[model samples]
Target: MKIPFSLPVIDDEVIAEMMDTLTRTGWLTTGPKVRALEKEIQIFIGSSNPVLCVNSWTSGAMLMLRWFGVGPGDEVIIPAYTYSATALCAMNMGASVVMVDVKDDFTMDPEKLATAVTEKTKVIIPVDIGGYPCDYDAIRQVLARPEIRKKFRAEHVRQQQLGRILLLADAAHSLGAFYKGRAIGTVADITVYSLHSVKNITTGEGGAIALNLPSPFDNDKELVFLRALGLNGQNKSAFEKNQPGAWRYDIIDQGLKVNMPDLCASVGLAQMRRYRDRFLPERKRIFQFYLNAFSRYEWAILPPCRNDDATESSYHLFLLRLRGFDETERDRAIQQISSCEVGVNVHYIPMAMLTLFRNRGYQISDYPMTYSLFANEISLPIYNNLTEKQLQIVVDTVVDAYYSIAGTEKTNVV
Candidate 1:
């Protein structure tokens, strides 16, 4: 029963695709494979807009921040409950990060976001924690308010085109998720999806940014610039420059080198091709299995996976919470679960608790909801290939661990 927290479902087909990519001459770096992946992603997310691939979510996010002209004196509001990359993207650009609290479901609370807006506010990054979509409608309403819009200062051309604060969704976990029947990519000004090893979809290590900016902002034109921006601001990629007598190129601006390679894209493309038909369904099944097993317990606070009429999670993680458990008790329970040969994890330690953000003047006490969610949350094993027998083992291990620390035993182990 030695089950791991998460595993990428790489089949023989995925391997064969990578092998085919490796065997191709002069196609290992960013080329046709990467372009095909970008198109595949556009189809999956039901978007006709441009989707830009980058080496990592952090880099893609930071690149977008630079495009918006965020820097000193500009402030980016983000939920304190998200991964460090969310805040780091803004911090790296020399912009002030204003941390706001999250809702009970771990998404950003729009009410607090309304209060966090200021004349310096240039971006609002609402993280969709645990694969669930944020309350985007409420957040959009907040940004659209007359008072909030009046305070917005557009310092750059792109910023002026948008004419208001940007809604950049940190949707690293919610790629396949939906908000009120609308996909994540279409709901935000821009949405970045992570393709890390542990993500629902993997490219070994990469990410894609879906561009859905409003009118007067041409996504196709923006795509060409961002593609070059990712390739160190070069006018042409190595793939394009490799042509006979076409080696000459030009550099426009100082940009980051974070373009996704063809080798990684091969893996992602293979998985994405069968994602709707195979991968996503298996993950959803695993999520439902956990919900049915844990819902019977009085102390188990199950994470939300679906809301029939509203949102649906991508089933990236099954975050289970223990009622009346503090951080110390939760840690002890995790140790017990580990001893049972079952792998478990905590989603995150709030950004406010980390030294980097703390030194920047953010306090844990200021974000009470973020602290509350982080203190008792435990992420369980969930992957595409987990069997029913292994699923039961995980359920049993977690429940036993809870009672072990509580000094109580249940007669029924089901």
Candidate 2:
């Protein structure tokens, strides 16, 4: 049987909650369920601010970029070791993406980001690639330089007449991850978390954005105003409209309809409730099992449990970086695993290596670290539903595949 990559660990709890939600007064777009989910996320993450539940993290990126006034002449720096959605959102907003290299650890390196900024740069949407949060405080230091500060301020004022350059975070893979003893949602000016099936927490197909915009950026009714912007600029939510005469509303801005519906939020709410009970513990246990099994292997370079003293991640995506391997060999290893009925996938190709950036004169050779990280990495299957037998299947398949691809005998296999 082919062991799939990550899949949602849905259970009867989710079914029961969803059933209960269905019996609630409303099933419309942004209703009680979404509010409950958002509240749960805020509490779980310890976020002081209420999170904005969006349809997807990609749309959250768009909403933040648009709110920050990113346009054709603007640029947003991003690490190349992430999914295309991190970059596509910038392009979708008519802003160019400046792809930077990643560190050996696969997270965005602050030093590399320092070199990527330019006069036209309006935002830096660094991704917490593979559920590993980047050094956000260090990145903030680079952006805080008087020269950078001046340029950022001037560019923002010139673009939207605002005074601050946005530090939007693509934290899609890090819903429950942490940095510096705090959650990922509170690290940057705006942090987006995905609730996709493959993420640590699943809402089936949903995401949330936590806003922490700087001063003169938002206060008073700004967050409330922004809430409306997230829901098609409509002044009143569906639940609010149920009240007499509250149906009369105004569209403050030309916003997109990217609100999270209660159906998806119901799943998220259940996932949140069972997170501490089932998902979190099982995920850690599974990771520990794999770590123990693979530690004896000569060619294995396991991913960081904690990037360093400053962070403690949710252990969502375990990036297995095989030693003594190149990109071609890595692909060969993946193929071998598939043949053995154990599916494997590469985290990314690096943004600069892709056609979209390559055609724009962004060279893969420029980001050597990003390329090197990509060349050796493989993502193993991880989910709560996987059993001990299934894990053994994965372990055996991977070892056998590694031996076959690296041209070593079964006796030499780890």
Candidate 3:
């Protein structure tokens, strides 16, 4: 019984949408479908802010940073525990990357964040690790301090308009999540969601940005800049210019080629239509099953799934930690489970431990909590379509392998 770590749920409805897009849409590039998907996303996330679709979350983050005019000498603070994209996007813009530690839940530690801020701090990206929402209210409180806001220096019009430090939620793992009765998209100044195949909801390979910033900073203007940047500063898309007598356009700004195509948007539209009614609920059930089964074992250290009435995870990844297990033992257990045809994986290797970040002068030792979380973390399968039998097999195999490696027997099985 081979069970892969993650699989995107696809069905006849999704296929029909894709086929209709390919055959019916004359404009396959950023066309009506892309616009439709953006609208659908706005509705799904319940955000009045403009939702802009892009080729990837990395692109979306980079666009936001560029729009805010984050550049050389500016500092972009990020958690050391997140994916490389979070920090790398800042580096790409030539801003200094200020790494911070995380809390036990793997979200950015707000206290550490306060100390990391400086006059040069332009943005703080708090990652929602494993589909869990970071403490945005706590982070906001840190930024709202008179001392913190007083130290801020604005280098661009966008920065000046914001007045205080910007909170960008790296919500790649938390699209369907909620924070304090508000959707994750609405909680941050800017939230970027990944629609990659491995994510809870996928658009084959795409992402979207939900802008929740204040007035005077035009999201439309910023999106136009991004579109132009993607097309070598051209002001009009191919579809827009195709209209009779509308070919005349002007160069807006230097942009990057990162617009979402109609093909990807078609798939995303289908996924979003069924997301609330089907995908989210199924993922939650699978998450609960794993939590219930693991609770019986004294060795199991569960990931944070909920925070009273304050937050709810998207159940994107089941980050299970083993007590009394180090990196070597965790790796051994994973290997043993794989041998039993059950595929398990890790959420991430902390940026500080990665070669690129190490070369950039980051040390894993600098982030003790990040390192601790990485060492014992084993991400179990949590997808929409995984059956009860497969779920049982996954739990049983993990238990058998853990006990086998530890040379112990399971006293309690649930």
Candidate 4:
């Protein structure tokens, strides 16, 4: 039997919603549907702040960095284990990217982050790789330290009002994840949730920014400003300008056109309506099934899911690590699994290992732990449409490949 790595669950509901958006909704781009989706997300994530939908995660992140006044000579701290987009967003804003190593669990190491802080640091972006939430409390503690706060030199009104570095969560893979019994959106000052095809919740292609800034920031006022920036700096959106006698508007500032269309927003809106009761629970069940199957094997190093009551994953990618295996062996194992018609993949190549960053003077040697995780990691199939038979095939194929590679005796099938 052949099985793909992942598949988006675009059911009849999603189709119907898309049709409704295209046919019934007169305002197609960045209109009522987009606003409704944003409101739904705010309610679902339990964030008391504004939730702004954008065209993509990268665009939302770029807007946030620009709003925070990141520019040349400024530094943005990020974990080296994350996708290149995390670093690229800051780089696009003319800010220097400061890479830090991650812990064994694949989240940013707060201790290493402490050492990397400097007076120029403007943002600390901790990625929730594979749906697992980072230790936000620990990272927050590091930023809140007197010396670290004292080192901060605010260069903009947003920076000066906060009086410290910003904590932006790259929660692309962690929309339904929970930290300390609370949803991910509220944990960070600004959490960016991806609506890409491979994410827990998909809008075909979109993203949302949960603005949970502290008091004196006026989140509502900031939301209006961000909405304008997303729409080519126009004071009035097309829908607003359509009102009778409201055609006159103003261009506030030079901003990026990254507004989310109502067409794309409709897809996610349909999925999120039943996400808590349907989608999320199904994903978590699959995670447990894999955990139960792989736990007996001493060589199968499971990815972090529910470590404690305080933290729970979105069940995005099930990254299984091979114990005592080097990079070559892991690659061979993936090939073996693929040979059996089961698709598999690696989570990512470390940012320092990428050619773009390497040319920019970054080195893999600087991030030892990040390299270690990348070497042995293999992301398995975990999607809502996966069938029981396909799951069994995946497990059997993986076990066979491991035994074949290790040249060990095959244990009896349980």
Candidate 5:
């Protein structure tokens, strides 16, 4: 049988919970299970109130933008090396995207990012791609610039500004990831985590947001209100209306339908139980195995676990790059590896390469480093259950595929 790219590891616990939710027959919305899952995530991240689940990472992304007050004519800075959803979230809110190039490491270079920030920049979404954390200190330093701060404040609010550009993180890749022992959750003003099936944990299809703003209301007050925003902006949620026939509610604001169902939340809660205790360490071991295999190969650049001594990735995706391979050779090697029964995939094509960015007149060639990195990148499977024999097959396939395409004799691992 051929190996798939990724799969959710579901135990009987998840199944049992799903059956329980069904048999109990009251949960069609965010209920006790969802609330419990939210608490679990909050305890894990140690964030203030306002942690909320959305239908997907994109929903969380847009919601964060909305909270930061990004709307028409506002521009949000985003890395070119990320999934389209990262930029699209800003675009969905009618915000123009200031696409910035990434370093060869596939992270936004903080220096380059600062240069892109202008008076119109409403937010900056730095992605922790391939599970490697971006340099938070560098990003924060850039956002702290006085002139930039004044311009953003004067232009956006025209009066009472938030004092700095919001560092909204697309930490969809980093869940357990740490920077200076601080988890990704509280690193930025707001960080959204993807609990998509392929992520470190699966909620079937879901995401969560964690806030790091100034807090006097850390009493889990914001979390209760946040649910109202997703479930029709009603003042009273279903559970709240369950009191002694006083089932009345009010529409406070016009919101969207993107809440996590108990069905999905049940899966997340189960995964959360295993994330720190089981899944992460297993993934770490697999990451170490890949590092050991690829370390001697000078052409192989390992993803950063920490940036200048301040980050630890979730080790979500192992992105391998070929040093001297051209585009055709890289694609051929991927094909060869697939033929060898290892399913390989590309991280992304720059947004500019697609019709949407092209229509906007954005040029991929202009972002030299972004194009260069994309040209050689291939995503290798790094999930928990990927076995030793499977890993050997993966390693051997990559080696043979490279040699088959390059037509070179077996060289040392380097």
Candidate 6:
């Protein structure tokens, strides 16, 4: 059947929008469409916070950390089970990365996070693994502790004014997700969403940052930082500088080239227009189908989808786990499935096990739960445009491969 793992859903409408922007708009870099996309995202997520579009989530995250004044001697706590970018952004800024193990559901363990915090901790990035939002309430409770708050040391003006740690949601896998009846974008102080090709919604290669922090921290200031930092610390963007007699501008500080072009924003706008009505529902249905099929199997340990009103996933990835399969058996099963022309993959290997992290004095032995989850996890195909026949083939192929690798009798998966 040749079912692929993940594919971006694009239609004629999206293409027409992109073409219109290319042909009509003389302004391309961070122009009107980019501004429109930011507004549309803010409306879609139901947040009044200002949204800033950037080249990638990595850029957005680094900017957030920089704004918070996270530098040398400061510590940033992150879940060890996430993609390396969650921790790397902090590390790149010269901040110490404190790795915490995740719970069985693959989200950060708030309890472990509480213990990991120290006086040097400036930021805590909780990743939404596979479109599932982490327990924001639990994390808030940890931060609310008088003991934890007393240990916080302010390194910058923003840090001193805030008087506590910043909660940044690494929402690469979750855009339309919900946590405790509120949108994922609004749950944390600052939330970063990735618009990569394989994500739930894409803007070719871009990301956005949603600032949900309270007063004294203005969104306009953050936008200024994004503009200055994205354009070599220039205060004016190309569009703004194009205005009559407005060519003169000032460079505040050294920054990077990380601004999103209007071309990418056009595509993102098209996707956002139909996201809630078309994209989200289909992804949820596909996830439900996988859950229904896999639930009957004794070995299937379905990934977290919904847990009462406290949380809900955006159905980005179907992270399936085997009950007793070790790393070798899981790898063999993946090989078997691939041989059948069915594409399957893993979420991630724990950062502690990676060579770069290992060389930095991290060891897998320190994160038993992270390694336990990584050893047997496999991500199945889940996308908006996947057909019913393809879904059946994916399920059947996985079941067949698992039995073949386990030397058990083949059973009907449909």
CA lDDT, every model vs. true structure: 0.91, 0.80, 0.89, 0.92, 0.81, 0.90
How many steric clashes does model 1 contain? 0
**TM-score per candidate, chains pooled:** 0.98, 0.93, 0.97, 0.98, 0.94, 0.97
Give lDDT tens digits, candidate 5, residues 3-60.
7778887889888777778788567567788778877888887765457777799988
In model 2, residue pairs whose N, Cα or C atoms come closer than 3 Å (at least 3 residues apart or on different chains), thus clashing, are none
What's the distance in Å from true for residue 165, model 1? 0.1
**1-414, model 2: which lDDT tens digit per residue?**
768887786679888878887776547567888889888888888877768888888888888787776779888888878888998989999988888877877878888888778888888888777677888888889988777767764544424544546778888877777888888887787898988878888787788888665555553355687678887888888778878888788888888778888888888888897786678778878888888988888788888767456686677877898788899888888888888878778888777877877888988888888888889888888888888999999888877777887787756435
Predicted structure 1: lDDT:
0.91
The lDDT, on a scale of 0 to 1, for candidate 2 is: 0.80
- Residue pairs in collision within model 3: 229-255, 229-256, 230-255, 230-256, 230-257
Write model 1 residue lDDT over 87-165, tens digit each, in one string: 8899899999998999999999999999999999999999989899998989999999999999998999889999999
Of 2 and 5, which scores higher on TM-score?
Answer: 5
Candidate 4 lowest-lDDT run of ten: 405-414
RMSD of 5: 2.1
TM-score for candidate 1: 0.98
Expressed as tens digits, the lDDT of each residue in 30-122 for candidate 6 is: 889999999988998998778989989998899888878889999999999999999889989999999998998898999999999999999
The alpha-carbon root-mean-square deviation between model 6 and the true structure, to one decimal in Å, is: 1.5
Q: Which residue pairs in candidate 6 have backbone atoms (N, alpha carbon, C) closer than 3 angstroms, thus clashing?
A: none
Q: Residue-wise lDDT of candidate 4 within 292-347, one digit each (tens)?
A: 99998888899999766679999999999988889999999999999999999998
After superposition, the stretches of candidate 3 with alpha carbons farther than 4 Å from their true spots are 218-231, 412-414
Per-residue lDDT of 335 in model 6: 94
Candidate 5's TM-score reads 0.94
Show model 5 residue runs off by greater than 4 Å. Answer: 48-50, 154-161, 215-221, 307-310
How would you encode candidate 3's per-residue C-alpha lDDT over 1-414 as one tens digit per residue? Answer: 899988886888889888888888766888788889999889998876678898999988988888788889999999999899999889999999999999999999999999999999999999999999999999999999998999999889878888988899999999999998889999998999999999988988989999887777776666666667766578888889988999999887766678889988888898889899998999999999999999999899999978778699999999999888999999999999999888899978998888888998999999999999999899999987899999999999989988988888777544
